[model samples]
Target: MNNDVVVIGAGPAGMAAAIQASSLGLKALVLDEQPAPGGQRFRAIEQRYRRLRAAGKGLPASEQKGLDLIRRFRESDTRFVDQASVWDISPGGRQISYLHHGRSFTIPANAVVAAPGAYERPVPLEGWHLPGVMSAGAAQTMLKMSGHPVKGRIVLLGCGPLLLLTARQLSNAGANVVGLLQTTGPADFLRATPYLPAALRSATLLKQGLQLLTQTPLVPKVFSLTQASIIGADHVEGVNYRSRGGSGFIECDAVLLHFGVIPNTQLSRLAGVAHDWNEQQECWQPVVDAWQETSAENLMVAGDGGGILGDEAAEMSGRLSILRIAHRLGRISDQSLSKLAAPLQRGLKRLAAARALIDTIFHTPETMLIPSGDTVVCRCEEVTAAEIAAANASGASGLRHLKVQTRVGMGPCRAQMCSMAAMAMITPGIRCGQRPPPPATVRAPIRPLTIGQLAEADVEI
Candidate 1:
């Protein structure tokens, strides 16, 4: 199985990259873990909408751009393999290994596009491990992928555009949105004003955000919440919080929490690509060159996986990446490549300006740095904040040390859920003013793979 290019992830970026590569007369293969082509943002939109209508629910407005891109990619000569997970990229990144339906196989590629996407930033809190608590992305997945809404009163908690948007979605879906707990305040808005003009370039997005924030029917809107503690034993019965007005409590059947998103860097890191700490976003971003190529030659990281610049930018970045690859492969002239890339680069810059405003406006509240006393920090390992503090007191002053001391990040999810929390606890220079600590170390099998599967893997020369 040799190919001209192999694009990992079938989202906006991967799909675009494969299509563009194929258009340039290169054989491109797209491998994705989803049963369908759309990533989380556009997850199962076409089929799920029909399911929604059959259940007597109105079809939510779909992402037309994503659907159109999917159609074009499907119609192209490129090959797409879904329900496949790439577990490793061999030395020099010229070979790819993946597992599908209990079988493992390997392929050779001239170039690889790693458009692996992003995930919601996890903020652990008291009772966050409760049965009814989930991330805002999870809630939206339920609403979009299935027509499932919260069974009873639901509360939207924390900050970010996703919080407000999910609140509106749930409200519009006829779910009982009991309240909205917002961490960001007017001061944050004032701070973000300088970047507002650039962000407002997309008037449609600006209007949609405003409507979601101001017109959502959720009641008892709580703003500038300093601290939120989920209160329940067997399950979440309500949430308690502190605000300028004093302490408050609200009863709810479920709580959807979000604090923006960070790149899903596990696989990229495992590949030993160079990474740097992004202070503004407070996460490690894979170091990519102007063409979205990483330090590793012929390996590219695009889309939210490179950095969380939104879906449109992801699509543009994908097309730009493969065009560069096409030029490198001598399929296109340098003059033609430059003609194509110049505009995409400028568009990404404008989108970056808009993203600065969004990041500033929805900045992570300081109170969410680490969980409160006794809060569960690692759901996979059932590790608590108190235990982490105990390890810290015993001289666990780094992520690796903390992991060894408390086994917080040595779980099945490979620290995806708790590494950030551990880093926050152990990162030095918090009191003094210095860059945050590096991300947790990533090792291969970036995702869990069975030994039997490894033994059965067939590699084609």
Candidate 2:
């Protein structure tokens, strides 16, 4: 099959890109792994909206916006493939191979938009592998999908706006949110003060943020937490935490951790695009031009997958990415492209300013990034920080070398959960004049695929 554009994801960026492509008379196809569109932010938005409306409850502004976007996407002429696991894209970004409904298929496209979205930063503390431990985002996802809050006593830990927001949402859903432990303290807020002038431009967002902080259910809250460890024998029983004030243990059935989100750069890396380390955000992101075109020709990355710019900016970026594709396809002239993109770029700039403050206020603490001792950095392979340190000490030179020595990034997740932590451990030991270690190489079959599925693939060529 061939398409003018192949969009990988159905989130804000992918849906918006497809909508823009359709508007420009381009043949666009969106491949999303979910059963429906609306990626993570709007996961099950259509279903949830119907349920909430049936119950006569008012939809939150965010959900309403997502519903509007999803509705627009559904009404657009663009094609959508749900439950489509896009396992690989050719290095040049012209060919995409995906598995849908247990059958594999390949599609050729003139341009590809990658908006796989972001994932929570992995924080591997002792006992984090316990059964009841999950990311705050995961809790929100469950609530969004099933319309039920997590059961049992919940202890929300780590930093980020999502942490506060999830706590409030869960509490409102009748979950017992017993404790909120935040790594962000007064020092982080002090650092963020300088960005307030720019952030003030988006007063509505700031107000919503303030409401989250104040409206969260009154619970045992700890700020500026220096360290934390989940305590359990088989399942999560409680969390022990240390902060500027002192130490305490929160007895809870569940521990929800959030250290903010980072770009899901695996596909971009797999596509052989150049990437740069974002020190401020503490993650690797694909190098994209002003129009969201990536280092590789005809390939673009948008949404949080490019970087953590929030959902609204993601929609703008999604639309911006398609403008270049449309121009290249002769659907729009250069002047037309520029005219259409001007407003989106301006909106992105405004959102970026507000993001600067959010990023500063919720910067992941250094201690959490570089775990030591017996902390398991690679949960999939059960690789420990001490083992990684040992490998580095034994002359494991770079990321690939360390992987060879400790099998850290060779797990089923392909280092999605552990690569950043592993990179942090490996970077500091580099000898002078030696080239810095490159990111772990991503290969084909990015997602798990059975041999039967491959054998049954229907090749269009």
Candidate 3:
């Protein structure tokens, strides 16, 4: 199938793009991997959709906007494909390959917007793989979407609004949360404070962190807590942790560990989009202009996939992307769209300023970065911290050396998980005074496509 514009994700950004495109009289099509739209933030929204659908009621305000977008596309003959995983996008001419219902299909669109949001970064603490140990966001998605019961007694670890929000959610969900642990160093926030005046002019959003630190005295606290390991062999019994001045153990069945999020840009790299390394967020995100356009002429990206701006920014980015898309398609002039969106654009600018303010107030610390000195950086090959150390010591420095010597990033993920952590251990210029490993080399099969699926996929599309 072909269309004037194809959005590869059904998240807020893609939905927004689709809406803008449809409104501007362009034929829009949206393809997504999930069974429904809303990306990660609203992935749980399907239950809400079912309930609304059952009641013969339309979507609520937020969801209604999304539904309106989908309906507009459908009504105008624009296409929407769910369970369509666009694994690879061949650049230049038009090409996209996806697997739907175990059958491969391809679509060539005149323009594309990639809104494949970010995912949790798995920082390897000792025994991180033990049951009950999960990313804070993962547990939230599991409980919210699947009704899966998380561990009974939980300790939410990490810094950011996410930890506080997750702790509150789990508490509300009936998990007895002992405490919400914040791992941010005060110095980090201090470093970020200078950026705040610009970030917090209006957004009271992260003000919660500062307020929690003062009031209740129990709700939220910022301190660095290093975990030795999650206790218990089969499951997480508790966590062994060490902090300044003393070491102690927090007895709990589960520990929700979240360092932060990193963009899932495997597909973009495969598509040859340029990416900038956000060292603070510890991930590589696509580089997009103010218009959300990427290096490729016909490609654009938005949201956390572009950078870690969180949920609100995600929705706004998605919406702005479609406005930009309309301009690129020649359906609407840039001046016209910008003038029409002046109010919304000003509001977004204010929010962006506010988010920056709070992120500085509660940013995660660098000290909590991946542990070095014999810590296992890669889990796939059973490679140990000692092996990585040896690789670093043996004149073999940098990620390539670590890979050649320790086989850290050579696993099934081909370095997605381990590369960031490995680089953390091996500081740049440690080897030959050269730059660090360039982003992992990307090729076809961005994600694992079965042989049968590959066979069904035609290159011509």
Q: Against the true structure, whose lDDT is highest?
A: 2
State the displacement of the C-alpha of residue 110, model 3, in Å, after optimal TM-score superposition.
1.7
lDDT of each: 0.85, 0.88, 0.70
lDDT of 2 by residue, 94-213 (tens): 788899988999877689999999999988888888999999999999999898988999999999999999999898889999999999889999999999999998888899889977
Provide the lowest-lDDT 10-residue window in model 2. Answer: 428-437
**TM-score, structure 1 vs. true:** 0.95
**2 or 3, greater by lDDT:** 2
52-100 per-residue lDDT for model 1 (tens digits): 5788965435466677888898988898899999888765477888888
lDDT per residue (tens digit) for residues 1-461 in model 3: 45888888877777767766766787777889888777877775657577658989755464465555445544544478899888777864168888888878777767887888887776777767677888888888887686554867787777666666677667655777875666655566677777677766554554655654543224433266644566777988877666553566777888888766778787678788788765445457888876677888878787778877766566677667777767766777768887866765675677766756555555544454656554556878878766776777787666777777878878888787777767766763323343455677767666668988787776544
- Model 3 superposed RMSD (Cα): 3.9
For each candidate in turn, give its C-alpha RMSD to the true structure in angstroms: 2.0, 2.0, 3.9
* TM-score, per-candidate, Cα-based: 0.95, 0.97, 0.86
* Best-to-worst TM-score order: 2, 1, 3
* Model 1, residue pairs in steric clash: none
* Top-TM-score structure, candidate number: 2
